[model samples]
Target: MTETIIPGTYIDVRAEGLISAGRIATGVLGIVGTASNGPVGQPVTLALPSQARTRFGLADDPRNPTDGANPLTLVRAVELAYANGASTVVAVRVAGTGKTSASYTLRNDSGQQIAALTTRVPGSWGNAVEVSLQDSEEDCLVERENVESPFNGVRYAPVVPSPRTRVRVVRGATGQAEGFDVVYRRLQSEEQVRPTAAGRFFLDATPVEAGVPAARISVRKPGGVLVDYTGDAIVYETGVPAAGTVRIDPASGELTFAAEEVPAAGAQVTATYGVGHALPTTGQVLLTTWSGDLDFADGEAPVQGDTVEVTYLLDRDSCVQVTLTNAGTVERFVGPDADFLSARINAASQLVSAEPDDLLGNQRPVNDEGLMGSGSNVHGADGANAGRDEYAAGLAALENQLVNIVVLAGQHATTHGDVLAAHLALTANSEHERIGVIGAAGSSVEDINAHGMADGRVVVVAPGIRYPDGITLASGHTAAAVAGLVASVSPQTSLTNKPLNIPDVDQDFNRGQQAQLIGGNVLTIVRKGGFRVLRGVTSEGEGMPYSAIPTRRIVDYARYGVRSAADPYIGRLNNVRVRDALKSSLDGFLTRMVDEEALTGYELDVFADRSQEIRGEVSVVMTLQPTFSIEFVLVTMFLR
Candidate 1:
């Protein structure tokens, strides 16, 4: 009997001299032997089946067994089977016992030996089926649900193997579908997906226009609530309206408006335009009055009644001349020149004249004829015409002609000399004439003493006579030496040969001869005869002496005292001490007097220079004597 074994098993045995063991194996091997020998003359000519053919019978040959066959031989038989269009050979079993051993060549279905098999009893075999691991087709749309809790309110999609689909997620929800569709079909078909994150996916969206927004924008307040009614326009809000038209400037992001006229308060008024536009208020029109008061607002409509009252004081010195124009609908007028002084109601009326009563009240009129009665000494017997008719008429004519006549009197005397002469002429002639005489005080006194010997027509008046100590004559005799001298002398009296009983006349005479007289002449004589002489009688008896005897030393001294009293005896002196003391004292007094007089005299000269109405040379001459007079008659007639 023969026993069959499965394929794919390896068996080993010691092939000793054991005929029975061989015989039993030969029965099983008879099938293998006959199948192996039928195809070839070799000991085992049958084709070996594959492991798969041994387990599951071959579809082409079912009787063949794969056990106890060489795997290399089976591999060759499989190659031949494949070439012959057969799948595989059938299984052929092998059986053996004890010390007997049998060997079978394993082959593939093509009859090529692939493995060797040796077996005794107690060996096992089985079939092996080949299987291939292949990659499965993937669907890109497949997605796993995300179950993890999201952070905050944002919901993140679950991670996938590839970025094939755009997954949408609710802000805070998880797992539940948000109804957002994903176009995964395109990803799966094209096999392409953007590698950017989900949040940044919008970066790949279509680009928008230069200034336009790709998405709708909503502006809200701080609370995230929308404000209502505001339009899309970029508006600028300010407390005051702009003065003129508003325009946008593209270059600078600032609002601009037209500039208005300057205001009266000198305020810096500004105008505003829309946002992102510059202020264009710079070249605006300014409306102002002649006096320069103005006000303006930009961007607002101007009305006929929208006027700014400008208060201005016209400065005529300014080069720009402004004509007063009545811009108001009603006519207006102004004063004196019609434009400056008239009211609106009196537009066509002429400006009224300024009456004398308007300014001067009921005073005397300034008319030429009316002025005749206002002067001193009018004409006619009545007081109204106090002998000034012809005079007044002549004066009026002279004044009307504005003639500047400089009258030169008969003589150029600064005192009352020429004036006294003129007065005498007028008195003698008794005619009505206008005359002015000017002369020095010295000349006036001289004239008075000469012509006015009996009458007291000339009066001396000192303007600013001062003393050595700067005391004015008005301060009385105690204050000034000149004032004291004036108080001692009688008014209008002759000062020549006036008895001045100097107690020290002898001493003075002696000193006067010792020094050469500096200011005036000195006379000295020697008397030779000596006698007692009565008034116009010479005595020879006891009542009188024999004859008059004259002394050898006789002196007479006098001085004009022009600038100084010591001038006469300043150089000649027996005793230098007495001479120097007297000279110094006298010189000091003379210097003070000269300074005061010179200053006052200079002031008087200035006054005379300014007196244009008074013609002729005016001078003020001073003398040491209190009384002053002129000896003109003595010079003219008595000079022989």
Candidate 2:
């Protein structure tokens, strides 16, 4: 049995039958509007409601119709988006002309400029921002200093101590207040008073013309932050080995030093880099160059020209004390720039803050040779240039982005050109899978119908929504509200028969108003306790594919399902096995949708004809029966 034949030796194999795909969330909302704060024309993803309040500064209150801070439309819309179950939102703040951030520069005891701080964005909100820096109490003990390794030429310490302790480097002397603090995982004992005596790591070391360079080395810190030797990733700290003495070769990732200013024998040489955002408020500070090297004994020394790594950590020893002076009074806000740093001194308080950035300027100093580009903060001006063009640009920013619903909060679709731009964006070559919701402020049924936006991609609401605060905003303001209601429904669920019973909706449509809204294809708040969609028709006439919201949604879902399912089989062969696998996957997806009640039934055919099969084209044909929502019911009652 062992020498001749093994009849029973076999391996069990499993054949894949069907591959199911998880449903993608087509519920990400995109809103474009003006704000009192935040980066202008930049897309910021909002995960929580508080981020909108904090970053965008949407906390201002307007007294009447013509308040200067009238961007509250975007604010309320963002609030509704979260309240109505929207999880992720992309908010773009479009700034007008001449918008500039407020800025202030600080000077040290010797009249030397220390740090320049500016607001995060261009707006009037920056005018109230105030910033101050002081020494942090957070500090670490210099656990074991070494000057042996060539990586750290002067006085270098390891990235992390063997005993595991905290270490922070203050910009000035220890315990000195009013000085910008610098925190690091490792400590530098003393600065190299003489550059000629200190060994320099050549950033532009000559390549050996073959294999990887022998002079190649990596500078790193704790938490896996590797100093980028290739690009302009490393910024030298102020003072020490002056600029131009060290050079970086982006192509080969090399760091060479001038021949005369090489590190002393057994000296550890290293550099430092910063990382974080540059935000200015009341209590904030920035970090400069920070690095650490190693020292080894006789046998511990490695081969010359070999790679070496330096590591360190940065920690806050104490808080910065900031005194903000707006108008006349001086208010003090103390602690780190993080909102959660202290419950008493949070971001909501009158005092503002400036967040730290390690990699400021990325070696692009404003004044000197060793200054960082990101270190200085400059408040920009918010001119009157912010308008429809800016709004259109903001909408353009959402092109090809994964967004399902779009809310043009402040722009009235009846008159504003921004609304037209938004509609055109949906049908652009980008083919964004989204629906736009816009409100028409104070416009009558005749006016809305005259605009003639027959596309089902956008919906216009009329009769402006009224709030309980004795203020009735324009009809266009309700777009965010409608979007929230639509978002509350599941992607698999249809909104054809859905009723929007949102609180704080003071205005309701009467019988005549409802008829007018239906005739004009406008959405309105029904008077019967909650709001009900009177008709499912889009801008197009009845019986069209996009007529019913459910019809459009299910079609989108089907398209999404098929595209997501078939993307994997693109490069595969068009043989029988591949065709069968694709058919099974597609069939399995449709079967699940049917089982979930999203579809009544669906027929999916992969490689339906021989002609398509020969051209290496996988022809997919799907005949779908959408799950219709019941808007009308008729019953005959027999007196029994």
Candidate 3:
């Protein structure tokens, strides 16, 4: 409704007619079981039959240790589920406790660990993963030059690094050098100043550091000693000093000499300070704590052709590949650097996740180490040892998925009825309508009757399925096969007399036993003509109203469709007109179902009373008659 206070004519276009139902899934199946690999308690959708081996490990993996007796339950179940026409499957790997992934450590040439590798998914299959290391081919080059000097012996300044580690000092002028006895090493940041004062007391320099000790400050005046002296006799006097004493004021950069012994005007005074490390005149080469230079103790030129070798870390561009192999499945990760290898492998490799340690200097692994470990086992990693908790948790993972059918692979409902009851309750509670397929307790009629489950959401199958070996019988997997079979067809298609592509049924049931199994509400499969279904009935007995599998499935499908179709109309105008449009949408859906033969007939009405409309409620009342499967035929023929 639009507000039209002063409007001439307001046209309101209702979009209720445009509301339509969305596509719904009818054949998705959820299966939970134990596997040798794959993440536990997470749903993984599998489409290819070969994905069973790659994701969950091969059933016949020789490293399974007890493959003769125990088998990987998930892989076989998935393989058989796909074998029985299940195109889409949501698989969950449930496991017992104590499950751990196999680990491998990569080391450099010095046996220092550089990277730690673990299986991508936790399981025993990761123990078969292998990794190898190789050295890089790139070499470290040298001679990025530092400092250059000459043997002038005029006190050239303490050497500071000038992009060269070695100071090249040639014999420019072969002369005697000063400070021959004192072995001085000129470090970094040393400045040499030759002051020509022109006048008597003032030096023409700017901002000399105030009051530094004479040791760091080397003032080589005429006939002045350059040894380490601790006395302040040269700097204490004011203006002028007594005879044979010199007074210097660093703030003014002026020197006051003794009045009687004043030097000639414009005398030369060499003041070298800020030696930093306090050494002699040289270029910045031989680094003592990243500072100063080469040997100038004797003022000798450094020997020519004497190369000082400096080392650095090189970028090893060698080929390094890590191979993760388990159950004949191999994933190789190739990179030159450890960090690169780790990033690539962790992002791409499905086998293992890697943690690379880029140590100080960004070092690379240099050694060749191979065959990290063989196949080891984790809890529930083998064929056996799955309990109810793991199964329940795995089923919980699939609760939010759009699965129409489900099966506890390799688990029997006769003993695990609680788990099956939970499965059935999910169907009854959630918006998603689903049914579970379970195998009978045994092939015996008494066993089938004693295994009483009164829920129509549960379908039971008898006699189990025979393995390809034609010897061993997996009774629990029979339910998985039936679930797949149910998922392969539409909800209206009955499972009766359908030919299954399995090798064979575990046991053959006679007509009497088949009748008893059907009456006991168990879906029975026999080898009448290439292993066909005998009945499509739920666990509820034949006398029950919802016992027929097609009846329950059709009802579930209709409920799902109606909910899907009408849910779009929520919060819309709950008046007679929109309610009728909603009714038409639902009616169209049901008519399509009836045309498709999913229902024999359906009576539907969408209505909202004045009180309901006031409460913003539009209710739908439906009475659907589902099409039933034909189970029996009788003919009394006279003499023809």
Candidate 4:
């Protein structure tokens, strides 16, 4: 028998209409028919219905019965139908008695029922044979070069192409057909591969209709580990050959890969880099103890001539005391470098006469210069020139004697006589009596006596003389000369006409006045003395004999004579010195006393010291007390 083979189906089948047309009569007909023959040269066309024929070994309708329906062949048929672009196919059914019918149901690869059919029915002249074939491609070998099976990394394989088979191609190595072009073309025409700017790959290169990028293929390892691609181009080496899965999407920069536990926790990471800028700073200046003549360095120089006050912590309880030594040395006339003798004289005069009392007293008498007189003398010759020359001579003699008297008075008062007495007598004689002579020329007793006798006789002989002879003679004569003259002049008496009765009344009056004046002047002098006397006496006379004088007689005398002196010189001097000394001493004493007492508020005390001393120059000490005994209280009440 001749047979036909179909690609992707059955291999061979019997020819149609080859069976006898008549049925055998039991046994006789069966044997006779077996020997009977038809025309030997005629081709007998076998007749069969289309429903009974199977195309590609499949029934026209899948509902038709075949040899129990081969499920494997059916499944193969569905796969080939899909691959061959057929919508549907039919399976052929065979009946009993060697007859067949084609009524198989049609179906697509999805098993959905379909209507496409190839059916046939055999004639009843004799029994017939039928065959079913699937409309599927044969299971033939399809060889490919470098065709990668999606499941494994095999390089070459002869595969039966199926609808579900996923394949890819690379370069071919041998005669096996390369499917790379076909795969590439299919991929290009249907789905494309693209690279994204993020260096990722995507299956569909075309942009989405909504203007979004194509979707990418991504794959993650266990625990969601992925492979990331930074925008920069990077090369990675596989130290060992690896056949692992990776997912990537070129259009979206999405990549996924598995990492082998990450070496340690944070491996395969990136670090960000940057730098920081420093801020500008203003300069500063530093100083040291001895930076030169200036307090700071030259770069930090101070303003010109600026005064800088610095403080030091001293062990002492108070600040150092500063005193001006010999401040009086600046005096224009009697300064430090002046002639010592001259300075001494001037100082003495200052001590005696510069008192507030003396300066404020009555004016000196007018002299020939038309100025107040200092009681210095003018002279002329006297004796042996009576009337015509005697007046001139006697006046000269009186002037000469007057000079001696002043000299005697100064010398006796400063040296031999009491200073108080000399001062008073000189004051009285000069201010009141108006003695004009200050020094004498004659030294001999006889010359002085002659001078005095001539002047004294003139006073008695010419009582009408405008200037008295006695005053003139005594004014200038030296004390020695006067004493000598007084001694030489004697009362020459023969039986002495009873001693002349000298009245004690006038003597007493004069003596009392002299004493009063001396006492008053002494008080004035003591009071006017400066701190020099006080400090000097205090320091030097610590155990001396006369230290009490300043506190006693001197103070009493000043207080008593404050109103008694008619001239008010003593009173003025007393008031000024007492006031000044009292203020100073009191200030010091009270400050200390108050500080010690620790009392508060406005309390006050006044004090004075009155004690006698025979020798010391200081005659008084005085003080005033503070109102507040507490320093803080005083500071708050008055100082503030």
Q: Tens digits of per-residue lDDT for model 4 on 15-80?
A: 221211121110000000000011111212111212112221222222222322211112222222
Clashes of each: 102, 64, 12, 67
- Please list the C-alpha lDDT of all candidates, in the order they appear: 0.21, 0.54, 0.65, 0.21
RMSD of 2: 18.8
lDDT (10s digit) by residue, model 1, range 77-193: 222222322222222222222112222322223434332222211112101111111111221122232323211111111112233432233333233323222211000011111
Candidate 1 clashes: the total is: 102
Model 2 misplacement above 4 A: 1-16, 62-69, 107-115, 133-385, 415-432, 491-497, 501-508, 608-611, 635-640
TM-score of each: 0.14, 0.59, 0.67, 0.13
lDDT against true structure, model 4: 0.21
* Lowest summed lDDT window (length 10), candidate 4: 26-35
Which is superior by lDDT, 2 or 4? Answer: 2
What is the C-alpha lDDT profile of model 3 across 435-551, one tens digit per residue?
A: 988776765679766766878888877777666655444566777878888889989899999977778776887888777877777787889779888888888776887787888
Better of 2 and 3 by lDDT: 3
State residue 25's C-alpha deviation in candidate 4, in Å: 31
Candidate 2 local distance difference test against the native: 0.54
Q: lDDT tens string, model 2, 125-151?
A: 666654444554443222222223353
**In candidate 2, how many Å is residue 194 off?**
37
